[model samples]
Target chain A: MSQKMTRRRLLLGGAATAAVAMVKSSFGKMVQTGIPEAAMDPTRQVGPLPGVLGTRSPFEHPQRKASLTSSQTPLQDLYGIITPSDLHFERHHAGVPAIDPNTYELTIHGMVDRPTVFSLADLKRFPAVSRICFIECSGNFRKPDKETITPQDICGLTSQSEWTGVMLSTIFREVGVDPKATWFLAEGSDAAVMTRSIPVSKGWDDAMIVYAQNGEAIRPQQGYPARLLLPGWEGNTSIKWLRRIELSDGPFMTREETSKYTEPIKDGKIRQFSFTMDARSIITYPAYPVQLQKGWVEIRGIAWSGRGKITGVEISTNAGKSWQAARLQEPVMDKAHTCFRYLWQWDGDTTEIMSRAIDETGYIQPSLKELITARGIGTGYHLNPVTAWLIKRGGEVVYRPEKWK
Target chain B: MPYWACVAGIAMISCERRVNTAPTHFGYGRPATKQEIAAKAIAIRPDGKGLPAGSGTVQHGAVIYAGKCASCHGVTGTEGPFNVLVAPDTADAVPFDRAPQRIKAIGNYWPYATTVFDYVRRAMPFNAPGSLSDNEVYSLTAYLLYANKLIDSSTVMNAKTLPGVIMPARKYYVTDNRNGGDGPYE
Candidate 1:
């Protein structure tokens, strides 16, 4: 790798010097005339050396936009499946806490036979497991009003990572979880001490206590020492900076579960503990900022479902009047984001394009109108609607804003 | 000692194969003490479980609110610079679809009274969270409830009295029924 980089650097240096010399000679006679010996490529040229760390090119400046409470991932700038650890979206109640892994401890008490506290090292000693999955904030939707919105602006709160940890079922078996314990409380160590009540069935199924993201230690914004990973569930329920897990016979009814994260549904009823995210998809390319061309354009996007693997993604070229299947990228895993693409030839005409996802459970993504009609206008959280992009005759792309109260 | 003998000894000590229905304890972590568990187990349930022994009056809470919470939640808890903790008088009568114009205050939205206490004690005072005493938390909870008209000024809130304060919106909270499908939403 070092040798290849050295050769490439040498070639780049030669090309750069030649280009500069060409520019210097093009208008040298008209302007300041004499090309000095030192002015024409007489400079220091050093060979590239191997480094312990790597960095993105200086030209690539993708960054996560942040507010006071939350930071959004640059979803439109990502490719393939895994989101870079630094670019992961963060939504915390208080702020990220700096914790020392050597002193980190997680307590599991309540309805267990033997209440134990596991240190960071002790957790790593257990059977190790790795899985690629996406964690999306339950409130990950934006009601766009104009064409200036990109896919990242529409939904930048979901990110996928190769999480590494032991299965929660393994720890449950070791602690001898009482069968009568219906729910458990997972709490964080931040200033807010964020807590959420989770059903025990999820723990027995596929819940994990992850300590690493991608291929390295988890980022501080993503929980640093440790966090609870509930696959296919809302991001808030997967408590970050995890420190305690207390099993109980019922939901603890914490403030987060009661006051926040709950959604208002039909018939004047508020819905609580709505965990699994529904099937959703968004077209990343040709989405707001990117203009469309008249000729062949490959429409690309990502689709994911909390229920299971994304089975299919259908694209509609002329709004929702007609639909066709988009090709799904290979190796679609369960509870993970799957990339999809479609080949299209856009004529010089104004049209609307959109994509809808169908998960393994045969559930199709709903439109914003359908969702509002069912849940009512005052609804705020857990909104997953089909996003549409409007392409004008002049190759301008814009978001099709839906009327949301 | 020969190197092969050391390798054989290491292998014999490392690999111990056993098949059992129950997972054997890896004996990794230490046993958590009763006191340690009590310190971190701060969650309060809807049934009044885990409430510390403390009491506070709405009058005491008013003072604390003006000093600590008013800057973020407004003077009367309705006119918020941040989040509105109290809604207008007619907020409850409004239908669910149109209530988005009004804030989801304790009177109009929160289902449980215990949640107020838990939220105030766990995360309040926006600037300095978890800095209030148990009595102070109870007082603030009482003040917010009183300001929202769920409770009276003379009411002294404690673990025993808090669970009995039936929030009007408690009956409106239902478990999620939206099983994903292609048909009409549940």
Candidate 2:
């Protein structure tokens, strides 16, 4: 790895190179006008050196806003679906545990004919699989705040990663799960000893025991050594620092399931174990804190769902009154973020623009009013209302606030 | 000669191409092992499989509750500035839109008795969690059940007997079936 050049250093180098070029080009009108002199000065540069550890570009910096319990992602600065491993959102109860990979173990016991304990090495030795999926917190929405708040602040508790791990069914087969068992309790090794009861059907499906993210060992903030990966499910269900899985006949109804994850619906009935996230989208560029131009502008954003593919994403320039389908970037994936773009002819008028996601299930993303009317104001979790960006005639963009009551 | 020098400089600049080489070494450690995995598998399931061996009566549980839990949860587990732990079985009553002005106790909302034991043992007592012994937890579970009128005051709870008691809120709880198609549920 080479020493990353900071913006200040690059600017200084550019100035010195310009002075040298000026001296060299006295007779002719400096033939090389656009190209920087640094491109011509070979002797001034150093060769590639090895042995340097991982690092980010000194000129660029993306960071998370850390508080007592959770950290918000910087969604405004990101350009793609894959979040850098370091910038992934975090929400841990009782703080992250420092587990030595050598000492870490995953035990599969209870209601199984063959109880088994898998060392970290044992899990890696099995057939490994990798898939890209998003893990979003059950409580990921916020009230309309100041214009400085990015999409990350609005719903940054969600993130996507190319997770590499053994299929959970491989471990389940090794343990020989009992046929009668319907649910399994997944417990974490954190200080709070976080735990949730997941259905057995999920274990046999797309669930994974992931150990790596983004082509490297998982970041400590994203469950260092190993974590459960329930594709497209609520983030809480994917327990980090995973240590135990016990098969059983019924749900554990843990504190998280009964008191926390459960959301109240239209009637008096509370929606418990509401796991999968509905389809949703957000405009990345020309959003809050980004100024727009008057003429033709290209709008880019991401759309995704837990149910299936994002078949279509509709953009509304007049606060969802008129809808036009945005061009879906090719190779749209299931339970993974799909990039979408729209070429809009901006007339420089003050207008509210928003995007609504329609998944393969044909379920249209609800507006804030529709969501409140359906779920009621008392419930705060699972809030996925379509987000609106208010673009001013002066080329400034701001978030449009939606009142609950 | 100057033209040749300019061509050589362009060649050197173009040669600075980024390589797609495989990472020969990693900065982080390797994966976790089976023995390490076994040291922490303490979760209990609904089928009474992972439950530890212990037994306690409603009478014994009442004493433990008074000594350890009554401060925050209130006497008899009814009053609370926090969550309520006991109530009469009202499976048929409509749930309040807001968390009721009165306490919506565990008997009214909790769907499984196994959860009551699993939760109390894992995180409870407000200030301290994982402090109660298995026997003590079992006794408190029985006491709460008795108070909620689900079990008799004389009932004893253990690994076997604890899962057998039916919960009032069990019928209302349904598995998520939202992925298949469009409806109020899916």
True contacts kept of each: 0.75, 0.23
In candidate 2, what are the lDDT values of residues A1-405, reduced to their tens digit? 123432112222222334111122567442223335445453464322232343343236677878877997777777778888878999987677799999887777767766666778877877789998888887889866566667877888888889999888877776678989998889888766789989999999999999999999998888879999998889999999988888888876676887568765655566788889988888877788888989888888888888888999999888778999999987688898888999998899999888988888887887888777665665667778899899999999988887755
- 10 residues in a row with least lDDT, candidate 2 chain A: A6-15
The per-residue C-alpha lDDT of model 2 at residue A67 equals 80
What lDDT does each candidate get? 0.85, 0.76
Candidate 1 chain A minimal-lDDT segment of 10 residues: A13-22
For lDDT, the strongest prediction is: 1
* Chain B TM-score list for all models: 0.85, 0.72
lDDT of 1 by residue, A42-81 (tens): 2343322333455453235677878887888887888899
What lDDT score is found at residue A74 in candidate 2? 79
What are the DockQ scores of the candidates, in order? 0.57, 0.13
Candidate 1 residue A26 C-alpha distance from true site, Å: 36
Q: Alpha-carbon error at B154 in model 2, in Å?
A: 9.2
What's the true lDDT of residue A217 in model 2?
94
The reply for model 1, stretches above 4 Å from the true place, is A1-44, B1-22
